[model samples]
Target: MSPHPAPDPLAARLRDVRVDFGTRTAVRDVDLDVPAASVTVVAGPNGAGKSTLLEVVAGTRPPTSGTRWAMAAVAFVPQRAAVPDRLPITVRDVVSVGAWGRRGPWRRLDPAARAAVDESMERMEVTDLARKPFFALSGGQRQRTLLAQGLACGADLLLLDEPTTGLDSDSGERIRAVVRAEAQRGAAVVCVSHDPEVLRIADSVVRLVDGRVVDGHLGAGATEPQPA
Candidate 1:
């Protein structure tokens, strides 16, 4: 990995963001910068738009009206496991979804693609489950599969929503470690969770309250209005 600038990393910038669910505003004029290789954990009370913020940033849910820009490649792992129970695919196959962009239209798997899938499984420590049925795995194992999916994307921006939800302490810690490792690898990782453990791994914090950033970073003098 190249030595990137410490102060300003290639990042995803949201300018003048606003979103609403009917009359209920989920996000209002929220501006944020998600920098590369930095863990920015978002925490807040219920209905704070923790998940919505991540979704908008990932381009899954576009802001009702705003300029959201991602300067580098990005991917998302939703709170729910995306694998279908009856798909009959294997663990390795689950991770390979990340490479769909590089796979030409209707192209079959080649040696290089297979190798990439293998590496993603290895990184998640699920190589042993490579040929195993994806639905047959436990929740922890499925979460790891999702982790591998994001990693396999080889993107500089990764968005994870409540990754540790419903996970035991051990599995949650293991997942947190992977998120930290992602940041150390020059990828910006934003994890949305109410768990303090999630916030502990963040280099910076964005505290949201009722659909707005109430505070920036978890420190003194951070209550100023943030760019949206």
Candidate 2:
């Protein structure tokens, strides 16, 4: 008899994950699995624990209970609002920071790492602004630069929060295209976005309400969301 197909590997998994902020619960009983080569979009209303869930996946914020597993290499890009606008650094400086994971902040990037930074900036259509101060760019440009930074990391898992919240049409489309390319190139991409276009293109959609996952559709290599 033929052997059964091997189960698809997961880039990240959270089983019965929960996060609490003092007296309030930020995320409750969330079970999610992110599969490689696919885009998973987390959709919910304001304060629906979307960002909190992403943090849990990113290994930035520990869950109060349950378990979380992720790839060793991960790149997380926070919303533009969370980033300072007055940093005295150029766009290339910002993108180069993504390589700090491989080489510490004090060390210069190796030739390969440097090439990755250049490629990422070109992919995001921010090559022309590479030498400009990051703070001087417009909202859309800033967002693209941040994405290029994330891309430069060469991480197996990529997480982003509200990547296209407020941007001009051109910038928004560029970001969306890059996101799709990342998944196609074998990265597991998880994003928290309210944009209808983003939601429509996602390989899977997880909907949260009041800190609980109300519904989810599993994508390739992913299992169904467990009951709360």
For model 1, how does the per-residue alpha-carbon lDDT over 186-226 read when each residue is reduced to its tens digit?
88888888888887777878888888988877422223223
C-alpha lDDT score of every prediction, in listed order: 0.79, 0.86
- Per-residue CA lDDT of candidate 2, range 135-220, in tens? 89888888888889999989989999999988888888888888888888999899999998887668899999999999988544
Give the least accurate 10-residue stretch of model 2, judged by summed lDDT. 1-10
Residue-pair clashes per prediction, in order, are 6, 0
Q: Which candidate is the best by lDDT?
A: 2
- TM-score for every candidate vs. truth? 0.86, 0.90
True-structure RMSD, every candidate: 5.3, 5.4
Question: Evaluated with TM-score, which candidate comes out highest?
Answer: 2
